[model samples]
Target: MLSGNTKFLQGVQIYLLSRDHSNLKSDFRHGNGKIMVNCIENQPAAELVLGKHVFLSVAEYYLRTKTG
Candidate 1:
């Protein structure tokens, strides 16, 4: 069983791996925050298993720490 943070990071890596550079840049500039939050929020089982506010906390941290 993966930890919530590990799952989230893996999800992000998998998601990024499926996109092209241009699309990734567009997502970053546009609706990436909402998209990421939605992705995490949609995983109900993961949320329940992790036993924390995984989506919001991860999203907030990602936003605050991510850089070019």
Candidate 2:
């Protein structure tokens, strides 16, 4: 997990990363680059809360995969 100064900003970072990862190719070709850039501009509080839930979901997935 992130710590200290980074912890505060991690959620927004994750949201942007998740949004970009979902919408754009690794190379970021075509129009998705614009959408990715736009989605990251606002940084809403709700998205931060949602991002924390997403982190929990990811941890659960990894734990289940490891156990099974």
Candidate 3:
């Protein structure tokens, strides 16, 4: 259980997540190219498009449902 003082670690997306094990290394980068990016939760990746944003944190969405 989390206490009032317990702090949640800032979830950072350092690399693009993938299901393919072979692509795991490639997910980090290709050649000298680096794809370091972090997705902010709730904030729209771009202007609001219909009811959904370009990217949303699946983990946070799941946690909200279970907690609520």
TM-score top scorer: 1
Question: Can you write out model 3's per-residue Cα lDDT over 1-68, one digit (the tens) per residue?
Answer: 11232121122222233334355335433623233333545422322221121123466456656775
Can you tell me which runs of candidate 2 are displaced by over 4 Å?
1-5, 21-68
Listed in order, each prediction's TM-score against the native is: 0.39, 0.23, 0.24
Answer with 1 or 3, whichever has the higher lDDT: 1
Q: Rank the candidates by TM-score, best first.
A: 1, 3, 2
Give lDDT: candidate 2, residue 55: 31
Whole-model lDDT values for every prediction: 0.45, 0.42, 0.33
Please provide, for model 2 over 1-68, each residue's C-alpha lDDT reduced to its tens digit, 9 standing for 90 to 100: 23354544665466556665544333333532222222434443332222222333476557756876
Name the TM-score of candidate 3. Answer: 0.24
- The sequence of per-residue lDDT tens digits that candidate 1 reaches over residues 3-58 is 55666667755655666756654554575332342354444332121112222345
lDDT score, candidate 1 = 0.45
Off by over 4 Å in 1: 1-4, 31-37, 40-68
RMSD of each: 9.1, 9.4, 14.2
List candidate 3 stretches off by more than 4 Å. 1-9, 13-21, 31-33, 42-68
Candidate 1 — worst ten consecutive residues by lDDT sum?
Answer: 46-55
Residue 57 in model 2: shift from native, Å?
A: 29
